[model samples]
Target: MRRRARELAMRALFAHTQGGVDLEEALRHALEEMGGEDDPYGDPLDEEGVAFARRLLFGYKAHQEEVDRVLKETVEGWDFGQMSKTDLTVLRLAAYEMLHEPTPFAPLIEVAVKIAKRYGGEHSGAFVNGVLGRLFRRIQEGEVKAAPKED
Candidate 1:
């Protein structure tokens, strides 16, 4: 159920991002359409899972510029415009989490790859993994701090 919530969040993000609608409204609309507590994809996520998705969305919105900067800085050759929106949204969300959340890199990376494979281009899983893995290593080596210290 949590997974489904993540996927749903991803889907909504893809919609807002690619469609260029207001992201928050688009996400809310998408979640509403995804069906209720008995959603067929799985048991509707519990409140915790739903809340997590919202938290992720808010975080993504709050720090998207920084996340995109990190992606542009970390990815060697690929430009943001050259990437698929699915891949971009997935990376943006993961990048925000990497910077702000205490979630471990391994599971976070796994989830990002899963999201990419499920929603992005065929190469998105590997692409996201490669980029995010490098960032994770930099963080581990103390070469980078999440988003600089918050004031």
Candidate 2:
């Protein structure tokens, strides 16, 4: 159920990125498309899951410039523009979750890796893992600074 929610969120993000839809609007639209209020399992699209997705989308949207800057700095010679839309979306979502939110890292990274493997090409999982691993190390090493300056 949680996995399905993430996949739905990713799909919505991809559609938004590819189609230029507003993020919240896109999410609401995604909720609708995914059966919206009728979300049989309870909690109206699983409040926790949809909220998680919304949090991811908002964080990524808010910090996209910084995120892209990090990606540019980290991925040598690989222009962000050159990345596949799906790969880029996955990377952004994973990086945001891993770096910004209070969620545990390993499982989120694992989800991203698995999603990449399932949705992207042969090299996508390795590619996402390598990039996310770099991001994780940067955070652990105090290289990638957090917002609001955690004490």
Candidate 3:
């Protein structure tokens, strides 16, 4: 369920950032593309999955500046313009979860890498893993502080 939610959230973020769609519209389109409840050919998300996806979407939006900043700082050589949209979206979602969610960093990074591999370019998984590993180490070393959880 969490994986599905992450996938949905990534797609929505990608649409919003790359396709220039608004957040709600991007989410609605992602849900429909991923197989809405009414789509017989698609794998529909459960209620919990949808809810979690919404949390990620809104949470990321709420902290988009910090997330992007962290990503920019952590990425060694690549500029945001040079990064693939899919990879950037996965990183943004992962960074948001890392900052706000209670989930451990390993699982979050693992999920992000998996999603990157599925949706990104050939080297995306390694790229995401490298960047996220650096980010996690920075967090652990007190170079980055996790934000307070929002209500």
Candidate 4:
């Protein structure tokens, strides 16, 4: 269920990136296309799942500039624009969750790599793993700081 939510959020982000729609609108449209409030377990519009997706989308968008900066600094020798859209989305999603969502480092990084392999191109899994591993290393080394926990 959680994985479904993440995938949905990524799809919405991809839609926003590729379709040029506002992020909220893109998420709405994606859920609607997935069957709205009706079909739950049978469709992608899982109730709890959408809530998690909404959280991810909002968090990702709210800190997009900083997140992009982090990605820019983390990934060496690759222009952000040069990234494949799928890979970029995966990285952004993973990066945001890694920093904010309180999921553990190993599971988070592994999940991101799996998603990249599922949705991204040939090298995306390895690429995402490398980039995320770098970020995790920084976190371990106290170079990349996490925001203070609230409540």
RMSD in Å for all candidates? 3.8, 4.1, 3.3, 3.6
Better of 2 and 4 by lDDT: 4
lDDT for each candidate structure: 0.79, 0.76, 0.89, 0.84
lDDT for residue 93 in candidate 1, whole number 0-100: 83
**Model with the higher TM-score, candidate 1 or 3:** 3
Candidate order (TM-score): 3, 4, 1, 2
Q: Give the true-structure RMSD of model 4.
A: 3.6
Q: Could you estimate the TM-score for every candidate? A: 0.85, 0.81, 0.90, 0.86
Q: Which is better, 1 or 4, measured by TM-score?
A: 4
Worst-scoring 10-residue span by lDDT in model 4: 35-44
Q: In TM-score terms, which candidate is top?
A: 3
lDDT of 2 by residue, 47-128 (tens): 8878777777877888888887777676655677887778888988877666677667778788888888877989989888
lDDT by residue (tens digit), candidate 3, 1-151 = 7887899999998989888999999999988788766544466789999999999999999999999998999999999999888898999999999988877787888989998998899999999999999999889888999855433
| Candidate that scores best on lDDT | 3
Relative to the true structure, candidate 4 reaches a TM of 0.86
Tens digit per residue, CA lDDT, model 1, 35-68: 6665565456667877888888888888888778
lDDT of 4 by residue, 99-125 (tens): 887777777788788879988999999
Candidate 4 global CA lDDT score: 0.84
Candidate 2 has what TM-score? 0.81
**Candidate 4 lDDT for residue 87:** 91
lDDT of 4 at 49: 85
- Which pairs of residues have clashing backbones in candidate 3? none
**Candidate 1: pairs in clash:** none
